[model samples]
Target chain A: MFLIVGIFIIIGLGFNLLGAFSLYRFPDVYTRLHGATKCTTFGTLFTMFAVVAYSLGRLVSTGEARFAVFIIHGAVAALVLLITNATGAHAIARAAHRSGTLPARAVVDRLEEKEEAKGGTPR
Target chain B: MTIYIFLFAAALVGLLAVAVLGRLVAGPTIADRAVALDTMNTLVVGLMMILAAVYDSVVMVDIAIVYAGLSFVGTMFIARFIEGEV
Candidate 1:
């Protein structure tokens, strides 16, 4: 049980660190959003999985009902994190584009092209 | 033993949050800062979950859930302001 929890935490830490580093390494808002959102979300998923596994093991060993409650609450928090992170990232990206922050060194901007085709100026 | 691991992980995540703050400070545009803020919120949620395990408190996890919801709302408000929709 210890080994399993340790492995999950190691992986989560690595991915979380990568997400932080990406914020510095990426050149623009879009790329930074891509790295920060996907990596940190995945990392948090693994961390929550570790917590669930730990709680399950405890619940089974001690047969304590509180451990079960811990598991349920942790799972709910993880679900909320997953849903909100994605929606927040989408909002930030759309706002960035609409606010005139273009992707760095892009060959094609489909959104801009579509707006142009629709006879609306790209902001 | 397991509690120590949880504490260590929480500390490492806190460090990562500090690292992300550099971007929040140095970002050239408002959008980049917004992205950094969103990342910071996610990291804080993860940190809270790990700390909940360390302290053996379910209430900590509940707080994490509420924090996530409130941060999402804050992000949406910032995004709308950036888009000139508010």
Candidate 2:
């Protein structure tokens, strides 16, 4: 049990740190958003999965109902977070694009004035 | 055994933190900063869950859930503001 708990903690922390690092290393808004969403999502998944594994291990080892509750609740929370984070990242990316934060390395401006000029999309 | 796993995970987290910090400090635009903040929020929730496991308490996990929800709201609000839809 102790070993399981330790494993979970370490995994969780790794996920957390990687998520933060993505914020620093990504170059443009779109790329940064991409990194933030993907890495953090994966990190969160690993951390929460670790928690579930630890809790389940404890329940099996000790036959405690509390451990079961912990697992269920933790899983639920992780699910909610996963759904919300993905959608939120998308919203931010769309907003960023609409507000004029173009890709730093982009060679094309089609999403900018060209779309509106051709009457292909609403401004 | 578990202790070794935790140590390894924590080490990875530390490395990720260093990389993310590099972006936060040098992000070229406002949107990039916002994105960084969003990622940080997710990371914090993960950290909270790890703390819960470390202490053998369920409270930390609960807090992580709440934190994740609230941060989602925050990210949406900021996105709206940026979109000028607020």
Q: Work out the TM-score per prediction.
A: 0.97, 0.81
Tens-place lDDT per residue, model 2, B25-76, is: 7667666767777777776677667667767788878888898889889888
Off by over 4 Å in 1: none
| Chain B TM-score for all candidates, comma-separated | 0.97, 0.80
Please give the DockQ score of every candidate, comma-separated. 0.89, 0.56
Prediction RMSDs, each to the true structure? 1.0, 3.6
Per-residue C-alpha lDDT of model 1 across residues B2-72, encoded as one tens digit per residue? 88888899999999998888988989999999999999999999999998887889999999999999999
Q: List the residue pairs that clash in candidate 1.
A: none
User: What shift in Å separates residue A50 of candidate 1 from its native position after superposition?
Assistant: 1.1
Q: Can you tell me the CAPRI class of model 1?
A: high
Best TM-score goes to which candidate? 1
Candidate 2's DockQ is 0.56
lDDT of 2 by residue, A1-123 (tens): 665556555555555555565565656777767767887788678778877887788789999898998998888888988899889988888888888776778777766777578775463
Q: Pick the lDDT winner.
A: 1
Q: Give the per-residue Cα lDDT of candidate 1 at A85.
A: 93
